[model samples]
Target: MHLTRTWTPPGAYDLPGSLAVLARGPYDPTFQVHAGSVWRTTRLRSGPATLRLTPAASRVRAEAWGAGAQEVLDGLPALLGEGDAPEEFVPRHRVVAESHRRHPGLRLTRTGRVLESLVPAILEQKITSIEAYRSWRHLVRKFGEPAPGPHPSLHVVPEPRTWVRIPSWEWHRANVDSKRSDAIVRAAGRSSRMEEAAAMALPAALARLQAIPGVGPWTAAEALQRSNGDPDAVTVGDLHLPRTVGYALTGERNTDDAGMLALLEPYRGQRHRAARLLTLTGLHPPRRRPRRQPGDITRL
Candidate 1:
């Protein structure tokens, strides 16, 4: 069955920018940009669905197909960032203020599907983006079901049970190491509990996610940032975020996580938003060292 909905945002809205965070990479099977609309596939509580969002004059037109069509249609507002209060975010640094001013329509998106975010976040742990995105693309294209809709190429992410049952060789073929694979399996085993965290307070939700084996502050924060639209879920252990944030905020070339936090103290309740604004400014310290190469685990 097909379903449709149109939503008018309360203020300025950047449709593509809000949903861009959900795409694992440019070639993500579950997400695509066709024409001017955004096409995305997801496994809702009811079932799998494909959603197409098109920007109109002053609103968005949404269409969905499959068993979960109604659910996806119903959640379109939240998914497009109706739940996020971008106005509450006050940028203390000049760069942040400039980014916030330039991208007034920018809003954080909340998918409200914990496992969807968690699994990809797990795959990204301590790895280059190239490696992590390739693994995600390979695994999803192999295991995920074809999305329901006009777009034949889109695919819905696998269910939790399917995630648990993926064979070891398939994972290896996808270049997923055992450590990350094990974490995905473990998290999948408790998918119901993890999904429930989407409704809990941010701190409690983060704690619940981190409770899973091999999940840490970084992973939990990454998951919640999408699943919950958590404005303050600042990623703490990233390889480049601290340096970028420090340089944008203080012109410091060697700021660690602690220093980054200190610089962001003024934007306590919206630290992640501040970090995002800093990143949007394209301000980063000059690279003095070679970039980390993407690992080729299949050779090992």
Candidate 2:
């Protein structure tokens, strides 16, 4: 489809770096292939051009090509590195900036939609990430839109209505319990409101999401970590983060959320960024039990 209209970041949408940066998402073909969440394909066009991005109600459509491709791809880090931290947290701005510079592609990923991030974050609550990604992949393949364009394998996230309307049989099929399903449905019910939250500041956006029935600190932090590139919104209550952070900063294997926060306090607004760097720095606690074991409740 030819877009004749205009945008503030005109041509900015066509650039991969800018899109990846703005979205703080993964752009690697491998990631696109392995990650069921990424829906990508080339549009048959006459001449050379890079990608195009359109902000839909639930997805960002991207297309790209030619010489401009490199320019577009180069801008992602700079774009996503822009943080939404409050002025009060500005003291650590340099730290974040430096950290991003130190670890250019670290934890910054540009997932296509806010709800995509939100739903997974909710699914991960009090559970393993293996379980969360499993549930996400299962549900999307079952209920999501067949992504537009040639790559039929690409699937957009399930619409809020779809989540709210999912049958119990499908939930069992996906191994999602009532709690996770409930949170997803409840969040979906407020999707319209959450979409509006995108325009709000980080704190406000997180606050609105937190107002939902089941979205709590971990989920909100997870959402904002990408939604607004919020620096201060650390994912507390994580099972392994404390130990990871503790080991990275203090060379110890023990730390609670509070202690992790304290250890990361020096970075403040950029705590998440630092955590991202630490993780990317290969500083995780030494192979704690062969990563996390998956729990498939569907078997039970």
Top candidate by lDDT:
1
Residue 107's lDDT within candidate 1 is 90
Q: Which stretches of candidate 2 lie over 4 Å from their true place?
A: 2-102, 105-113, 287-292
Clashing pairs in 1: none
TM-score of every model?
0.98, 0.70
Model 2 weakest 10-residue run by lDDT: 41-50
- The Cα local distance difference test for each model comes to 0.92, 0.58
**lDDT of residue 300 for candidate 2:** 76
* Tens digits of per-residue lDDT for model 2, 1-300: 322221232211223322332221233221253332232321111322234445433334444434334443343333333222222332333434454455332333332245656877787788775666677677766776544434435555566777889988788778788888888888888777876665677678888888988888888888867656665667888888888878866778878999998878887667776776555455667764676667777887
Cand. 2 Cα-lDDT: 0.58
CA RMSD for every model? Answer: 0.8, 8.3
TM-score of predicted structure 1:
0.98
